[model samples]
Target: MSATLYYFDGRGKAEIVRLAMAAAKVPFTQVDIKEKQQFETLRAEGKLIFGQLPMVEYEGNHLVQSCSIARYFASKGNFLGSNEQERLKVDILFEGTRDFNTAFMPYGFLGFKEVLDNAKNTAMPRYLPIYNFILSRNGSNGHLVGSKLSLADLGLLEVILTIEELLGEDELKPYPEVQNFLKVMKSNEGLASYLRSDLRRRKNDERYVAEVKGVLY
Candidate 1:
């Protein structure tokens, strides 16, 4: 394949691309930078689109930004939708997941308690109901947007898992439709295989958030 992903080999921001590729069975070169020396070399490279990680090099063109990469692969795999209306719905739901990640980043990734406290008190309560409403309204077929699997579905599952893993499981208990949606996504053959793959097993550890999971409401 001509596609190549250059990232630190973590699930933090690159896993969505990995997930999209896996779901579509599209193979690419996974260039992982783990050594500090290599990281420094790549970081000093001036050709980066935005001077950041998660940059995708495809067919000799380097694309920066995570969502752009996701959308590109989603389109390549025909995971967007069949029509413009459905495509807009896909965009809406995908943006919702992005909002969730941004809202929870300070708490989940940066360990910022002020932000985490506000998220638990305000953002969580607000978005939980909104997501549940979206799921109830559009996910009647147990899908996030349309009546089939799409990148939006994958994004929603990622947000749900991030919440359950980073915030707490109880965080999604009130959103039954979302919970059900995640269950389906988790059971997807490609997604399940990737989640259980040795690459994932060796890279992720849930123990870091054990204490947060215990205290999440």
Candidate 2:
């Protein structure tokens, strides 16, 4: 059976898993949690395990933690690495993306605009340049750890797309290396299709705010 994912209707933290699945060509189903009551019911049934979302039912296991779920899908798709050394590199870069994502997420009363601004200005400057350098060192070809795509690449793609949603596109114009890397990744057939599909979420606007608030409040 395909894995079952339970998360918010919008992307939020769960989109990485979807992207990983798409890259892996693995089909799965999802249960969209648009309200606090839906989340409560899942938690009441012990499906959430930690009373939190981004949970996946795969291989008879209930998995939570955004990074853990992303890792699971990425690993399933053989996107982790080809060897121990490559896996180590993937882990290092993936953790950085996790930290970058952690710096911005949902809080009912918290201003979404404030979070996006911090992510774009403070967080983007500190991380994007370093990532751009890493890409340039790797020939700016999009693969971060090896000749093939890995979890690190997927993580960075998500980060870049999120920034695009914030800046109305090409927010990484100053970071040419990273922007080039983005082009290479977007050229992938599977990823390109998913990007054009309806699965991708919208910008951090009122609709996003309402969805998050509905789930939290």
Candidate 3:
């Protein structure tokens, strides 16, 4: 089946979806809307669901929401889980990453030193410990669900890398399991290649950072 992902030019919410597809060796077209005018035009045309991005057109069907789209691709690639319980474990960690992103994105967009400090001091302490615990429970094998790779792993990897970029390399040092998990995920051939490819944007690209800051401030 043919698939095309629609999102902003930068990584943002769509990176997990792209990572999943790439890891699974699934071929699909990526449509990056680089201009606000293009995004507005698509929204005005009523083509985007929920008036937002990270939508996927798969086999003529439109799927919305970043997590849902990523899950769909994971299912298609057989990276979800082998059974019901495993799927639940995967979902829990996947949703946890989403919650972490929800808490982190606002501070990122605020683009102020105080906001960053608050996140570093308060929010990270609250959330990272829980994520670190989850990783420890799973043996910190770089896979968040079962003993194999899942969408949860990809999701957590994105969040971890984003946090590392915003904070620093040593930000996850307090969570050794999480740090090990990051190393394992980055060692995957497909993910490693994608990270080095032109398709992947630097986490702190000024253009995307400025765009987010402008929208918030």
Candidate 4:
């Protein structure tokens, strides 16, 4: 299938799908609608969406919503789960990540100081313990649910990285398992390469080393 990821030129919600595509070794086109003029054209044509971004145009079908697109590409790459139970586990992780993302939203898009203060005071303290509990229930420190990698792990990594970015690398210091999990995932070759790739740098501008790397594992 010819897969095209359509989004703003920069990395936004659609970033996970891009990382997933690269990690899966699935060749796809990156459609960057950077210019406002082009954005207006797409928006007027009902192509660019209000509630979604980084949407995927797959063989004439436009897939809206970031998580849905992630799952679509993940399924294509066999990254969702190997079974039903695992799939549910993946759902939990994704939702948890979404929750974490939601918690962080109050602080995001604002200046770094406002974002950091909110995160440190409200977001981090609230979410971190819940995440720690999830890890405790799973089996060990690193794995969130199954003995192996799941989409949830990727989601967790994504949130954790966000925390790290906001609060600095030691943001995850309180959760050793999460830190260890991130470390291991980053070592995965496919994921590692994607994080280090020019595309990621171009999109994020800042160096991103956590969740994108975890997805490939």
Candidate 5:
């Protein structure tokens, strides 16, 4: 089946889907809409569902929403879960990470000192402990669901990376399980290669960061 992903040039909401597909060794095309006008054009043309990005076309099926896309690719790659119970567990953590993303996005985009401080003081304290507890409950195995890696782990890895970026690499020291979890996910050869690749590095450009800050601030 042919697969293509549409998102902004940066690694915002779409990173999880890309990571899942890459980890599963699924070859897919990534179309980066680098400008606001391009996105507006696509939306105006009714080419994007839900009037937003991070959409995917797989086997001729168009999917909207980032988490939905990630879950679909995860299922396709056999990284979702083995059974109903495991799937439920994976969904719980995945949704939790989504919630964390929703809460933390403003901090990243706003790019204000106060916003960063608020996230570090309020959001991180409130959310990180919950994730830490979940990881601990799962035997601190670096996998949020079951004994093996799943979509939940990939989602959490994204969350952890974002937190580290916003705060610092040392911020996760308070949550050792989460730190370990990040390490394990990053150690995956496919994921590591993708992380080190030009596609990932180019997303960190100053222009994109400035654009996000300009729009939100």
Candidate 6:
């Protein structure tokens, strides 16, 4: 399916789905909502089911919500897991990322050290250890579910990348298993290419930040 993702010029909530799509080796184009009017227009036209973005027009369906789009891509990519139990594990891990995303979104958009500090100090401690443990328990195999990669793995990479962008790359030093998982996943050709390409925004852009603040603030 030819997927068209609508979001801001930067990654925002769209990154995970993009990463998943990339990993799935599916081709999708980005429609950057660089202006407030652009998003407003889509909402006015009822293109957005929830009047919000990170929406994907895929296979003749307009998929709204960040996690829903990611889940769709995961399902299409066979990354949600191979079995019921494994899929549940994927959901669990993905939910952790979603939780962190909800909590840290303000800081991500505003670039506030105080907020980032609170999340890094409070939330990171609680979440990172569990991720580290999960990876470790799974033999630190870089896959949170079975032997192959899944949404859990992609979600972890997305979270780790965000932490790296805000807290610096060395932030994962305390959690070697999670850190190693990041390293191992980066070796995937699709993921690596996306990471190194302009298709993926590795760091939040100031202009995009201003646009998001202008619209949502």
Measured by lDDT, the strongest candidate is: 6
Residue lDDT tens for model 6, 10-48: 777888889999998888888887777888888888889
Model 4: number of backbone collisions: 0
The collision pairs in model 2 are none
Using alpha carbons, what is the TM-score of model 5? Answer: 0.86
What stretches of model 2 exceed 4 Å from their correct place?
106-109
- Model 4 lowest lDDT segment of ten: 207-216
Highest TM-score model number: 6
TM-score of each: 0.80, 0.89, 0.86, 0.80, 0.86, 0.92
lDDT of every model, 2 decimals: 0.71, 0.80, 0.77, 0.67, 0.77, 0.82
Model 3, CA-based lDDT: 0.77
- Superposed on all Cα atoms, the candidates' RMSDs to the truth, in angstroms, are 5.9, 2.1, 2.7, 6.5, 2.8, 1.7
Candidate 1, 88-124: lDDT as tens digits: 9898888887777676544434555665677778767
Minimum summed lDDT over a 10-residue window in model 3 is located at 103-112
lDDT of 5 by residue, 1-217 (tens): 6578877667877888888877887777787676667667777777677887777778777788888888877887788788999888888878877777665655435655766777777778888898889889889668888888898888888878877776787999989989988988888887888787765624344677776444333
Error of 3 at 7 (Å): 1.9
Model 3: lDDT of residue 117:
79
Model 4 RMSD in Å is 6.5
As a whole number from 0 to 100, the lDDT of residue 60 in candidate 5 is: 70
Q: List the residue pairs that clash in candidate 1.
A: none
Q: Is candidate 2 or candidate 6 better by lDDT?
A: 6
Backbone clashes, each candidate: 0, 0, 0, 0, 0, 0
Tens-place lDDT per residue, model 2, 76-96, is 779999999999999999888
